[model samples]
Target: MQPLSHLESFVRSAESGSFSAAARQLGLTPAAVSKNVARLEAGLGLRLFQRSTRKLVLTEGGERLLQQISGALGTLSDAVAGAAEAGRQPAGTLKVSMGQAFGREYMVPLLSDFLARYPAILPDWHFDNRQVDLIGEGFDAAIGGGIQLTPGLVARELGRVHVVAVAAPGYFGGRAAPTHPSALAGFDSIVRRSSPTGRLRTWTLRGPAGEEAAVEGRPRMILSDPEAMCRAAAMGLGIALVPMPFALPALQAGALARVLPGWYADAGPLSLYYPSKKLLPAKTRVFVDFVVDQFHARGFAERMSGAGEPVA
Candidate 1:
């Protein structure tokens, strides 16, 4: 690697247009600045500057060298500054991946406050259902359910992802709600088809007392997306098995009602996944902490775990 001192002196002299001015900037003697530039030129086998009695002017090669090296020097300086700042504060782009429905419903709403708290950190979020290769895709973090933990990746559980059956209030206007998981078999249901396997899914539900039942429904409509299934149920199509996050809003709005209340399918933990780097970026650290804090504060953990009692 070329000496940073040599490159510094060369760039400083080029920008200042004289050895003496560059010396003032570097806190070095004019002679030392001139020596460093001369050494740099000799090392590169080029005459970088044409010296007159009045001022030093760039030769054609000098102009090209300046154009090339100036940007590199700036980049190097920025890298050094960023490294130093990493110890001091969270700053820079915070790239996070999340499911579209979850991010929109949960995270995007909190961004205003997060940004206000950390003005230096810019949020770059990708909303998609596909499991991203966090390191390979250059993502700082991800939040979702059922993300397989790969080597060098660590996960912090935000909560459990439990699936529950729900339907529009109008759908159950006259019909009685299912009192148990087995009763769900009698209802017309909107169900998910596994996107990867292309097979219809059965809802395997666990009651509050730890009873498990797999209910196969007469599929009124088969869909893969959870949001779509919830919407279908909201339109009074049929009961839908959906993640609690997707169902909660409609449930709260009274657009939908929970069916077989205590029974839910345990999909697994919802987690925030990030690289297990020894020195995590401050941006990633703060973001992870912030979101986790919000989840706990909102009782999202409990709600996601199917603790929120269904409305009668």
Candidate 2:
């Protein structure tokens, strides 16, 4: 591999648009910047910049190289910062913005465990379902899972959240079992105001033809949150398509029954997102690490249900 020193200097020069400016910004002499770029071009066997008396322009080759170089340098920078921050065990307040149901169901238990482990750290938690502006709201991190991701934030995948279509035993007491997702149209359903999936978002099932199956249902009870959906299904009001974490407790208590376990949709991953910055303070890093380590991708559903799942 070519030396990163030369590649970093090359990227800095391209971004700054001049050797002198890049040198001044990086605390190196103009000649050093020129030499680094020359070394980089030699390593790649390509000319990067067209240098004139008054202006510097990147060659086509330089533009392509800059794309890869910038990302590499940025990753290296973050790695360095992470290493430096790890030495310190941070103490202070960490503000978390999360969905109301998720906050109550999972984060509360997770936070209790964290607080017990690190008594010095006190986190202020806020629960809301709408999109939140992390910088505007003064939030250090957000625990949100869905396909929609906020631009300019770094999102780390926690795990896939499984969704199950459920109803009370009495609701389907006399009716024949629904064989397909479309069959749910014949039954009442609880729907939230919004869905993670759009029109195409439906339960994916393997059909008789060995092809994938999808079905759409009309909402009998349009609810605002997962709790309402779960309750409606438990009360034998309708079939509710809800996340596994939300229905797990009731399923174990025998209050709710899984309608079609083999035909439920697999929702996407739950993620912890934060800002990608030069210095993620010690408290934020520790919280991120602690929560990620705690989740480890598998135990969240089991933990939420109060079931003992094998450790991931």
Candidate 3:
């Protein structure tokens, strides 16, 4: 009989789109990952991945098998870790997915304390600018701003994410600042694909009469990374509606100035979400409890913000 380890490796390699990346994630050598995948394929007598020198493409069969195995694999992993470390500590890996911009600015640094406190639990992190399917790809948890929760999953809100509409000092020198949301059409703006919304984002606010101020204009630059958009806004490329935390340091340094402060829309909440389970296995329970405790005790809602009324 094929072991769960072989099946899990094959699924991760396929989902990650490469052996090397999956190997790095699973804390195994590339050769080890390759051998395990080969073992699984040989046992089934089926070719799961169509491999090239540059990449691995999943076969149709691989996709179906991934569906069958992913849920079971998660359960098995939770089960084994549960059985082995019952009273000692939560051991084994927790897969965490997140975006590039805020991950660098916040989550990465915050995780150091988490790791130190829970030495038995290891986090296998996937950082990307693109939104991933949590259920299909099998991430244990993801911390990000602007996540829209799907049904049957649980989204634990950390706090409100503040945003600022900003431009370079030179860009606004002689020009009138946008006092009304309708005035935004006159400026060159930068647009970013919001990972939380899974849409080409637009800036919106409530006008004086409680009307939705739809700020639409041609973007001088379009980017997926929030950090890039913040940098571009500071360099005078165009106006950028950026998360306050991403721009907070620069704003403090006087490198960027807030434009249309009254009309700026608050960012969606930062959250750590997971697939809700009946058992809430020991590892998930411990981590979730720890995270909730960490934030609630430290007043995360007040901290992830820059300034202004509470958006949540």
Candidate 4:
């Protein structure tokens, strides 16, 4: 029988279409992953992949074997990991993916404490602007908003993300601040272009009276990132609608002022996502618990919800 490691190497390489990608996910050298796959092939007396300089093409036999073993291998691996480390300190590289701005501003602050508690765990975090495939990419966890919940995954809601209109104090140049969402159209606006769909994003603001108003700016500037929009607004460019998390710092620093303080757009929930397994990994479990605790203790949920803002 081939070792589980050999099978894992083969499966991961096939799934990723490259030995180097598999190696990165597995935390192994490319040479080692290739050697393991070679060993598995030799033992079975069959070629699993037709390798080229660019990518690995799975052979017919490889496809059949993968279909037969993928689920079983995952089950076995989860069980083995749980049973083997039931009482042991979780010590391994913990891979996670998160949005760059949110991860840097919020999640990164927790690193020091996380490391202090689990000194043996090494953090390997990837900061990205887009959603990532958690299980397919072999990430231990991810954090963001608006991620579609796929099979074999679960989410823990962190907070309601709210979008508020803001601008530099001097942006309006003595023009009266907008009293309603509809008034925003008369002003120059810094807006966001949706990354996944190449369309301009629109905002609908909800008022205290349960009334809603759809609004769009004059498109003085367009950016793909919320953080950048916040910065552009702070630089006296134009009014911008940005998520509370991206605007909080500037708002706190008095660099930006709310445009329509009584209204805000309901974006979505920020969440921590991970694979749903019968026996979750110790590192992931601890990290999840710690984050939930921190968020509650810090009142981040309320702050991000626009509930903490004083109504004008």
Candidate 5:
């Protein structure tokens, strides 16, 4: 098959009726344009032009070829230009995956302002507890912690994932508040079961002085979702180890009290995950930047670290 340049040269030369005019349009020398046309004719095994010193005339085959490819070339050029324009302008359906509780609590609130700013961008969000295959599942972005950094994916750290023990203030009425991680084992605990592994999740808390202690929560209620654990704790079901992002509102509202203020388990970094930065779509790029900026502006990283002032 002839290269696109060859087809372009032939088409332009035919349209202009002169090699020099085609060369001027293509930003090439007349000789180069003639050579490209000749190469195209040779590849096609059909003479496409009857050349003259004064003007170039299209042969029967050239006329047929021109008729076949001219409109197609225009359409291809339009498609390319449209794609480039779409890249420059942030306007598309942005599909994002995030945790159910975290998305509702944090990201969903940002939608009003985000849509107001980029009115052309339509947000399609999926809320779930498990990690999603960003590229495979055709997701624009995902927000969560502990997601494996698979090949072809990039993560921007929004904050640290810290799990703090929390429970209703009344649940601690008769029993003494646990000062150490080991003491958590004696209380009625609401623990999460790993979604993938189906095994009980354990907590290893790190103190301010770098002391580590394993928490063996005696599970009165075994749940799969962190938000459910927080709700259970709020209902005075048991002491629950919940991620700060899921537990923050309850703590601030006095619905739940921090069990051990000085200790928290560093699960991993909460991140915005997307495909590689190369030729990243405008919608995804803006959304990533917006979320990161918002997280920084709101001090979400520090507040979710469990090292902030007690919220109970």
Candidate 6:
């Protein structure tokens, strides 16, 4: 019997008219989707999609196969979805991905609560800085900022991520804290290198009253990890722009202090991304709702977005 995954890929590609579109819906890469379709065609000894740079057109055999299997595929999907919804327990291995620092700070603590709430759901969470392919790598969901939306995927805004300037308490022992973004020029700055691009990131600060300024300073150190940037700042190496989540604990412990109060760089919304909205498994559905609820309940959205009274 032909593999069901290939059939699903074939039908989705035919309907969507491109592998990229099918990839978005199925959570696989275009290459992977094409490979699946090609494999299906090889097994059946037929050219399914007319290879082209512009658009994928189905062959006569492909059309016949699609017409014959489309109904069966729908029936299979509905049956599986019905079974998932009717299951008494949301018992399954829930694979998830998130940023290492963000996960450590926010998601790790919440796992206990989530597991407690859904005893049958097993959590397999991977923490990394790189963007993950949710469908290709088989992740049920991902939580982070700036996730690229592909076909069939949905994003829920958890909160805004803000970057703030931080320095060690000792670094400012005799010097006054920077009152404005321009004053940061006097300090030695530890900047982050973009992991994917290998380029240094610049810090642009937005004031409470809607003022904007980009910090220009002597680069004392360059690091790639946000946690390390915060640590370097705490150790008096240099003032660093860091995500608030990575700096929160040290700030609370007096290891690091905010340099410019009420000024932060908005890094856009932190989102929880997952696959298509149709007939989602109970485990994934509950987890998405639970995480969003936690963010709202704890005021993380306000704190992270630099909107609340203050972080004192």
The residue pairs in collision within model 4 are none
Tens-digit lDDT track for model 4 on 89-141?
98888899998988898889999998999999999999998899786678989
Worst 10 residues of 2 by lDDT: 303-312
Per-residue lDDT tens digits for candidate 5, residues 100-169, read 8888999999999999989999999999888776754658799988788875589999988788889898
Query: Which of the predicted structures, 3 or 6, would earn the higher TM-score when compared with the native?
Result: 6
Q: Residue 66, candidate 5: how far off, in angstroms?
A: 33
CA lDDT scores, all candidates in order: 0.83, 0.73, 0.74, 0.87, 0.84, 0.84
**lDDT measured at residue 103 in model 4 versus the true structure, 0 to 100:** 88
How many angstroms is residue 260 displaced in model 1 relative to the true structure, after the best TM-score fit? Answer: 0.9
> So what's the TM-score on candidate 3?
0.64
Residues 171-229, candidate 1: write the lDDT tens digits.
Answer: 86777777887777788989899886889887678888888888877778889998999
Worst 10 residues of 5 by lDDT: 73-82
TM-score of 2: 0.64
Off by over 4 Å in 5: 1-83, 86-88, 310-312
What's model 3's lDDT at 204? 73
Please list the Cα RMSD from the true structure of every candidate, rounded to 1 decimal place: 13.1, 9.5, 6.1, 3.3, 14.5, 5.3
Question: Which parts of model 3 have CA positions greater than 4 angstroms off?
Answer: 1-84, 145-152, 193-200, 207-211, 297-300, 303-312
Candidate with best lDDT: 4
Candidate 2 local distance difference test against the native: 0.73
lDDT of 6: 0.84
Q: Model 4, residue 217: what's the lDDT?
A: 67
Cα lDDT tens digits for candidate 2, 12-66: 6776678877775456888998999898788889999999988689999888888
Residue 130's C-alpha lDDT in candidate 5?
84
Root-mean-square deviation of candidate 3: 6.1
Q: Cα deviation of 152 in candidate 3 (Å)?
A: 5.4
Error of 1 at 112 (Å): 0.8
Query: TM-scores of the models, in the given order?
Result: 0.72, 0.64, 0.64, 0.82, 0.72, 0.81
lDDT of 1: 0.83
